[model samples]
Target: MLKTESLPVLMLMGPTASGKTQLAMDLYDSFPIEIISVDSALIYQGMDIGTAKPTSAEQAAYPHHLIDILSPSETYSAAEFVTDARKLIKDTHHKGKIPLLVGGTMLYFKALLEGLSPLPKADEHLRAQILEKALEQGWPALHGFLKQVDPKTAQRLHENDGQRISRALEVYYLTDKPLSLLQEEKGPCWDYPTLQFALLPEDRGWLHERIARRFELMLEQGFIAEVESLMRRGDLSIDMPSMRSVGYRQAWEYLEGKCDKETFIFKGIAATRQLAKRQITWLRSWQGARLIDCQRSQSLSQRVILDLRSQIEKYPIFM
Candidate 1:
């Protein structure tokens, strides 16, 4: 069995379209490692196109955990993620392989790497009520209501972001506590040694261009068709977490008769660019470890493998 002192974890993070997934797969091919995804969007089943989840072929190539294991209908919170990831990390360590955590979900990574304060389970009734109100009153009306209850969270989130606004209000109603207070008390609580690496593209403009291109590629790959299938199910609502994801949200509008194909393409790319921007800002705030500019790094695979090996050797995980 691997002791906490011996089996160090490797965390590979980066913004969307930074080539982290391809690099992680490359490293997996070279090393004895198991991947535990940190992506929030990838957790939902049937959310393949937008979340960029590894295809079945890729999973056959390398073992990946915590991905495509949940349905959008279920409530998967960060607290729940931390619990499962820590267990998976321990399990992988027992099998004598490195637990390689990979993805772009900052919240999940932060909660897992640091620790999360205990928060009350979401009041589903309250959540449903909030959504019903939003459908009738619109996001601005709901946002206005949140401002009355929790001005701090309301100010931080945009008025049109119905999902987050509802969540914040639901938290307050459930626990009688401000979401901000819960955040301050949470952090990575483990003593296990961990190495964090980020694959950053040096050129912002280049990354934005790549983001736009990726959305177009998804379109060509039948992104809308995927949404149409879900729409036909009628069980998947736009309020679901998976549905709120970047490209899926815009495509959902087209499926709902809210937009034409042209508008969907245009808005999808714009939303993806915005998501990339948020990801970049989130990565900057991460401290420690290494930052590789994947855009400029020659032979990123070689460099990351060498780096991973060096970190393992330097740390010397003991059993």
Candidate 2:
């Protein structure tokens, strides 16, 4: 049996389309590490094209944990991710390998690295009801509604943040308590050393251009047909967390005849850009993570491998 000892975990974080997966594959070829996907979208089955999921061949060769582990109809939580990832990390270490978590899901990364505050589970029915109310009344009006029940949370979240607002309301209704108050309680923290790295885009224009191109490619890859098959399942709705994902949401609306194909493409690209922007903003405030300007990095594989070798040697993980 492997002795109980400190093992370093490696994380490669970046916004979508920042070449994270390619770089990760290169690193995997050289390193003794097991990959655990940190992406929320990749957890669902039948969500390949739009989620930019690795191909069957790639997955077969690479063997990522936590991909396609759940149907899109079910929901996942950051707490659950922490639990699952901790186990995977331990399991990998037991085999004398490092755990290399790779993806753009910063929320999962945060939950794993710094831990989370306990909160009530999501009630889809309540979420749909809250969202229906928001549709009838503008998000600001719903923000006002949230203000009455959870003033602290409302103040923290912008009036235009419909998703968070709806979630806060759902929590309040479910537990008959304020979401803000619940968030004040502490939760479990990870007990391992970690070396976190991020591929940050220094050129906004380049990242935006990449997003546009990737969106177009996804369309060519039959993103619509993928969503169409999910719709045919007769168990999904637009409000489900799975369908609410960036490209999938727009395609769902387009198939429902709410918008033309051209408009759908425009909106899909715009939404993806917004998601990338949010991810970049979040990464900017993160502390202690080595940032790589992927837009300008040269011989990225060599540089990153050297850095990892030097750093992981300190932990004696890959030594």
Candidate 3:
């Protein structure tokens, strides 16, 4: 029933361990589509086990784009993701295939769909000055300053959230304007139609169990060793984006002697649950997305596939 002149892009969104990848693979088998990973952690190489990245065999078979495209030492911004995903969407459409973007990174999805804020670029000197002040008075002091100038943004940011606080202050210093005002100017949205669906588990308890099990599986998969190996690289730090990922951050802290083994596991699982909670919260307020409530479904089965296909068929198709 898909009825648009332009090609339609498919978005398969879900929280951590919500069967997004498996569902996407199954959809690919049935529809003429290409998969693009929307995950922030999946962009870094050498982060497979911790990130639950697709295996080499699975990726080779399915051909996921934008995975393992950067090293853990580097950084990729949401703006970059918007550019890459838009180009990939256009290319996939040119190839006569729908682009299926699947992942838990709601920020990337939102930026791609709603466009980005017109924030100023990072100034190294300004950031260094902010960091120096933070070193002397601590980040909480900066938070107080932020509250005075941009109380709206300050209300949302944690006092210890150095990165975001620094960026917000830097924006104020550069433009002499508050960050909140600039964000309200939301740049430009994508033009093509998109078919959006998010897998919403009916039971919260079941989702938590899945998250705990997944974290345990990650441990069994040498997740600790993976972090250790990356740390040994002498280039990565806990503050780096890749190392700051949910599990990786906790694991890195454990390795740094900040916590015991049991505490590490508990914190890791808890952090993952928090991440899933945030993702679900984002989807709860997502506009133009169908929330498919599935019961006792960790992985999408034949029944789910057929049901989803039928739902997809109900939409208008490109002629």
Best by lDDT: 2
Instruction: Evaluate all candidate structures by whole-model CA lDDT and list the values in order.
Output: 0.82, 0.88, 0.88
Best by TM-score: 2
Model 2: per-residue lDDT, tens digit, 234-302? 999999999999999999999999999999999999999999988898899988789998886567778
Residue 29, candidate 2: alpha-carbon lDDT = 91
Model 1 scores worst on lDDT over the 10 consecutive residues at 310-319
- In the range 4-115, model 1's lDDT, one tens digit per residue, is 5456888999888888888888878887788999888888888788777788999888768988888777768888999999889888888777888998888888787678
Instruction: Tell me the number of clashing residue pairs for each predicted model.
Output: 7, 0, 8
Better of 1 and 2 by lDDT: 2
Off by over 4 Å in 1: 125-188, 315-319
**Alpha-carbon error at 17 in model 1, in Å?**
1.1
Show the colliding residue pairs in model 2.
Answer: none
Q: Which stretches of candidate 2 lie over 4 Å from their true place?
A: 1-5, 123-182, 315-317
The alpha-carbon lDDT assigned to residue 257 of candidate 3 equals 100
Candidate ranking (TM-score, best to worst): 2, 3, 1
